[model samples]
Target: MEKMILNYKEEELIGKIASVDTGTAIAFIPDDKKMSELQINQLIAVNSPRAGTHIIGMVVKMSRRLDETILQNDIDDKKNDDNVVLPSNAIKLVFVGELRDKEGIKVNVFKRNVTALPNIQSSCFRIDGDKLTKLMECISTIAANAVTPLSLGKYFIDENSTAYIDGDKLFQRHAAIVGSTGSGKSYCVAKLIEQMAELKSVNAVLFDIHGEYSDESFKRDGITQLKIAAPNDLETANKLDKGILMVPYWLLNYEEMQALLLDRSDSNAPNQAMQLSKQIMTAKKSIVKGTEYESKITLDSPIAYDLNAVLQELHKLDTAKEQGARGEKAGPFNGKLTRFNQRLENKMSDKRVGFMFSLTNEEQELDWLQKFCRQLMGTSKFNNGGIKVIDFSEVPSDILPLVIGLVARIIFSVQQWSAKEKRHPIALLCDEAHLYVEQNESIDAVSAIGLKSFERIAKEGRKYGVSLVIISQRPCEVNKTVLSQCNNFISLRLTNVEDQNTIKRLLPDNLGNIADNLALLDIGEAIVVGDATLLPSRIKVEEPKIKPQSNTVQFWQVWGKNDSTQDLDTAVENIIKQSKSE
Candidate 1:
């Protein structure tokens, strides 16, 4: 006689394991009524010989195949028959983990790795209703024992119980949240932020590419909001309103500046880049002339320098003539520096980038970098959570990658250089990551440089207490390098075949069926998998108290309203200004 599980009952019997593979098992259901109730993603248990232990699997595929002999007879007769035959239901399950009762203890423990596969003819039971609720609660306790769990929402299988993820594992290992438009991607992110905000010293930075997260969303007691200085905010730029942001040009290293101002397509680009490098070093040296850093500053140092002085020297080089054997010969850089000069002038004069080129005198102080670091990493009354939401809505698409990468690099560098004892961990929530972190066949010099910075972070940021939360709608468009580095994934509905395929490729070979219904997921429903989760589970994310401003528009409701003509002219003017919604 088989020793029954603690809660095992005859009524709980669903079927028997017909076959067992490395990562999946096929269960045969003889009862039509029992088969009807079986649903995809539902959890089931297969009894093992070990006491208080069972193999856990999730339903991934279900089908009813007609008896071949019966079907062949009707086909051969080519005539209608009155007899009816019930088809056998085949339930395919993806093995997730092994659930066992700890020795001498009543508690059940769930391990992601399976120690044994179910043998053929093993009895399988449906773990729904009360069974499922109890199982999830037990798993939640297991998660809590390892580390503080992050309560994202409720499990799809057991809505009565909350879904918990290992918070430490989730961040220590990078994470990715992906879904289609209107699939509640932003809502999930907002909810996570809301939870982190509850901590006394939360440290995170959300790269708000479209200004999606609003003040209302983060109006919580420990959250802070900040916006980048737009074109219109230039004249009044200051830290007073806690509204201004300065990504000073001096902060960019030689390679970053080259990406911003050097056009490699030009035949003379090489010569020009060389000249620009020298001039930057000259300007940096000039700034530290009488300071202690005079002997220590490198060309890539983040020290303040006069852009005008560099431009003046470049102008002289472009017009200088050298006395040679051929009397009054043009300088080697005379004609080569013209185009480079124009590019630099345009970037410096562009009002849209005032945040980089135009900064207050205070922002140029030697200790400004220290203050900036504190603002981003400190949890003081003036700065909430050390959580900064930097809005990049007005940033141009062409330079978006470089600018965002700059900020990430700064954060990583600060943490890297800090003394290990004094280092504080920080998480970067990159919204709209695909726009800047995509893999491409051909890329411009600037984008190549930007890509390098992010790739480095993805590969090594973990060692320095820096983590990334890559958020995107199109997983296919995101860089595989970054995606591969992530050990946790929160995937919502994805309708595109290509997008679905991308997620499938990342998942383990045995769990391919697990992502088969990605396109069919309900809004806010997601399959949470990887290191953070105790077991691969489907979750229905809870709605945030204050919604993000980027929620999908109700097209039907808006179509019912008429547009106002009074503001039409102003709207057109704003569009032309390139600062319309700034």
Candidate 2:
């Protein structure tokens, strides 16, 4: 026997179907009484032409007009005694899913596919109150039954029922969580992190661009806080013990090094790149002298080498003179490497990017790469299911993209080279992704390199056990290719027309009406639809127990206070020091 998905009483009937399309149907109410209480987005069901199936849809548009019969007759004398209006009302709904009578072991099964359209004059019933709640509960059961279920919050359709998005599906394919500023993008991210923290084993690294997620609130396991080594750290001695990470210049491949040091507009750019490449190979080869790598080392090999040695070699080329037919003549490369040498020297001395040039005793060893990658990729460090928050707050803005790319590339490359059995899955929660992954690819070469690294992850990271959680405030500005690759979307309020359109394009054509409601979403509320979610709908995302620090300040309230003060001297000193730490 098949169970009824929605048990409705005789009085609950709203109308009868008037017309049908490929995936939509129109139903006209028999009277104005039924039309008065109807609302947009209200779920409704209609009898399908196929036996043992019902089509589920949402009220998209409601219209009422004068009945045709009333206009046919008019009498002046009758008008003086009584005035009455006859109205015809109808509602347009797009089919979202269908309820089946029986499917294998499941009875009254609900699916996102409509196998058949509703029949003409089919009775339409409004899904409300108890029926709505039970239907929502059934969806919850589907999520709860998943192999790796992830509870997000309660469904807005029925607050009493909990909402769960399939976690396995969410990460297996890429996913995106986008909204306008203060739309709770951070709140939703925190909820995901809080859940990951409580699990037996979870692995993810959040790129904290604005330093908002550095707090250790989710203590189910420890959360390691890491900061890119800043200028102040150079004077203070950069150390891993304090969670300050130093990415020595030797770690940069030949191309990345050029992006940081080469001036693209310089006429001598080609020569400089060649010289830098040659010197890097020479410097790296010195470390592997008489070893197996001596014959196999490449210029891009991430081996800790002496940049000072490379500097000396470039200086020799800049000033060297060779015997010529006449007298002493410039060497084959004399003066050609001058500009390149100066640029490299300037970057090495610039304290703002000291992280990339500062190489400590421990960082100079051959095993340093392995140690660093382990620290970054190993999420279960010390038996804690802790998330690593990589803070790029102190990194200089101009080179921030390159630095982020450097880290992302390291993790990705290491995973790609690892044995299949040894490789573990890792998700990058990219906060403020728009700053790095831009739709327009020509602005910053440094950022462009970074964008490619991420794009590769979006395209083929699944096979390498890598996934991305692209978090952004401006969906329109993000790379369309990367955003399109996301199979799951948890979108908060997006008021901008372009951003809304961007999301609309990512969704199926039938769900365009749902995308239209992006502007109407409340804070902490989101429209979740994709592979991870079974029923596409809105949900008030559960408040994370450990909230991130990305909160909007109460500017008006602060201005009204009389006790506010500023330490100008201290502020200036911190700015000069390029750090907030005392």
Candidate 3:
């Protein structure tokens, strides 16, 4: 009732349903009304069998066809006009939902399903102006009743209508934000960040693949910014206080170590792996020789052990001489461990991956895990360390998958181990997820090892209180498994045919053709659909007060300028140092 009631008047009549089906109906507009008044995606309220309800639908297609019967007056002018055609205009309406009256309830409600379909000849009217506003308001009001409703932008159907979605469903069941390179993907993320920052308790880690988020605006009062150790940070990164994050190699499991160090092509790969595992187990045992952990320490345990000792043992086994019946022959693994040794030694010596091997004495201590997890996943009421934006720009691409996977595994593992009742839920905002979450049977060993962690999270993270927000510019390249698990999508302008089809295939069968609008969307405009939204809508994203550093550089404007303030020396020095430019 109230203002939500669709008080249809005879003066507003546009058409009558001529055909009805399971999920759609064809309405024949009267010849007196112009087809120009109808538009694609225009909301329609068709008369229903129920007393106080109407079948809500949108005009998906329209056509003007010639009537079969010849007009009596036009029959006389048959020679003047061929066949004397009388055109009839009709529209195809796909039923979306239903609008029900208050019936004594405090407010009218719009359910996603209709109780009855409109029969043939039912009058249909255009839902515009007041009716459109009221209908959109009903959906918004339903979400507004939630504890954490997310306000993204205004509906394109009605600019006056502010769009909202269920924030809990958006994250709890996972979500994805996909678009072209400059299609405001980052702006949407920054908008979400700005909104989440206003809440009392928010715990999330945004993996900043590039250093774009290093700007001051992203460094809000409650957020912490951290960077992976670079070649230059080796000498200075002894602690985690000043934002240098060290994920020591000891945190990696056995298979991860094999993927990182062992050469799979080598014939001695299996033996080399077995010996490496044995050496690691021995090293781990030394740390807890006098404690109960000694018996339970496995090669896969997350315990700080002497990697140098493992190396020495592998070398000994590599060149070991056997005590044969004669003088001395070769040992079982004399030369099998040579390639493994070389790879480990080289990676350990490389300063680029110092974050994994170059840990200080303090970091090697048993209590380091407590401090590390606390700083990254802490839920302090003051929000000092609740939100973290970890920058991995300086990390080498060769090992990017390994390092990123390591960090994600750490977060998920910690949450998995925590008691369910005491779990402090966290969101993993995986920026540029396509890099590590690749979709192919031919990915390399490192990427495969890395992909497993994310796939597991996509499959089972919800039960453990972990949510993933996958943000990428290319949906075609991102793995479908992870993308399919997402229950919500905020899709922006996508021009590529493959990328558009990727999204089209994922949409519900009824909404499949909606992807046709993907290429036509303007910048900052997106189609929002999922369990979070009561109605799939096209919205214009609101401009965030604090925007990300993803603005496209005005190349032409910069080129015309006569400014020579650019520093060549600093750029050369940064490249030489294998670090980010200041």
Candidate 4:
């Protein structure tokens, strides 16, 4: 191949170097006629003092042309007198050095050859033309080879040299998918997870709050799907195949327990929570004679400390009568006695009084509480699997935090036990991580496990085979510490300045220009950064072949419907017949 070259006359004006930026260098182009066409981001070659050498650099920017009147008049007079007017376009050339080597330094310098100068039309350095095409092509080839492991059939490449996906690396630490509301964050997450699942080595757990994943019947892939409902739906709840979601009290460390149970102001709250955990474990072991300490406890076991029981105990401690000369003492033993008495009294009382007491006193609600807790932490013997979903859809909003915390604690405990042998690497994917990490909310359990345990996993998870995937729309709403620890990031379109800035700070310095490209990203397109990619890539994310379609409702079409009487008599008859059979 013939070498393309640009020759500059030594007599031409060589203006001084102006400025240098991250991706480009700027210099004053002295030629007045060609200055108007000197656009930003043009490519140019720098001629060095050394012979037969040329350095390639892109023109990131150009200095403004200095307006002068005498120079124009002199040119006009020369043109009319048949005197050749020197081409003002040959003034000066500013060039940015390209990374010719892996270290990204400018070593090759352009050597000017005055004897064999090419004509202006034959010159490779021209304004408003694609100078970086060769360099972009080189980078694009590297990115294309990086994604070979993903097996993405075909993808459209962006013309602007902004986005590409590198699928060659393992993403075993932590990752987050973030974007605006309509920016396809969820679709990207689903697609990414789907691809991961296709990798036979990967085992993932997705916490789907919207029930959108229930349509797994669409994909006949090898996946176990389970739906947990409130204990009310006995038929469906009983049919779930996965084991029940149970967190043994003994599993939480001191700090995690404090976050779960104690008030924030309580100086010894963490210690107390730890003590409470130990006591609960001891009591359960004593209750169930055969179960060993720290062993997995089933829902049917008598030793299991029902959530209702724990709450009832707490209530008793709160409302205990001070031990005067004649009054009962306020302690664990006395509290348990009081709780037992309260239960006995409620059982013996009249229907109205019992009902009122059960509704009013927290201690009196123990029986129903036990049932509720059992439903959440119980195991199904039918398929010999635990019930993973407690079906909190029927759970009241106030106590949702408690349920969430309890479940998180359980997951942490299971992982902690397996951490010793390095078995069964568990990954916890928090869909709306912002909600749990929010400052105001009482997500102590999740915060404890997330910050302490999950953060630890983020830092050292790859070694232990543990990982975390946090998906959130508002990056600003998430904890900065946790966000900073993520080794991988799949950022989608984010219009919010704060969210954009957060991503900007997390990405490496070389990717600053790539971060600016987020706003223009299309749906399902993302700028992938961090450990998983060799470089920041504009990846055209593949959509899951069998993903649940959860787009917004078409209100206009629904509103176009006309009212009609559709056999109310048959509906009522069917309801009555169903009730009779029940």
TM-score for each predicted model, relative to the true structure: 0.91, 0.92, 0.93, 0.59
Root-mean-square deviation of candidate 4:
11.8
Residue-level lDDT tens digits of model 4 in 130-249: 334444444445555542344222222335453334443334657778888777776776665555555443445555555555454333353434433332223223222332232233
Tell how far residue 266 is off in model 3, in angstroms. Answer: 0.3
Q: Best candidate per lDDT, number?
A: 3
Higher-scoring candidate on TM-score, 1 or 4? 1
Candidate 1: give the clashing pairs: none
**Cα lDDT computed for each candidate against the true fold:** 0.81, 0.81, 0.84, 0.47
List, residue by residue over 1-582, the lDDT tens digit for candidate 2: 635767666787889987666766667787788798888888898978887777899887677875645422321123311233322577778888887767788876788888888787898998888778878877778878965568878888789988888888899889999999999989999988877776655778889998888765743464667778777776454366566788888878877887788888988888888888988888888899988788897887888889899899889988999898999999988988788888888988888888888666777888877767766777676434447888898888888878887888888898899999998898998998988877985667788887878888889889998899999999999998899899999999999999999999999877777888899999999999888887788999988888888888889998999997768999899889888766
Show where candidate 3 strays beyond 4 Å.
Answer: 1-3, 32-34, 66-88, 380-385
Judge candidate 4 against the unseen true structure and give its global Cα lDDT, from 0 to 1. Answer: 0.47
**For candidate 2, what is the lDDT?**
0.81
By TM-score: ranked, best first: 3, 2, 1, 4
lDDT, residue 108, candidate 2: 68
lDDT tens digits by residue: candidate 3, 1-582: 257568788877888887666777777886645577889888899988998888898877776765634333232343332223432677777788888876566656788887998887898988989779988988899888877667989999999998998888888999999999988888888888877776667899888998777688877766778888787676674457777888899999998998998887899999998998998998999998997787987777899998999999999999999889998999999988998899999989988889888878877999888888877787546336467888998888878888888888888999998988989789999899989887787988999888888888999999998999999888888888999999899999999999999998888766765677899999899999888898889999999877778899999999899985689888899889888635
Best-fitting candidate, scored by TM-score: 3
Candidate 1: residue 402 lDDT (0-100) = 84
Q: Where does candidate 1 have its weakest 10-residue lDDT segment?
A: 78-87
Error of 3 at 198 (Å): 1.2
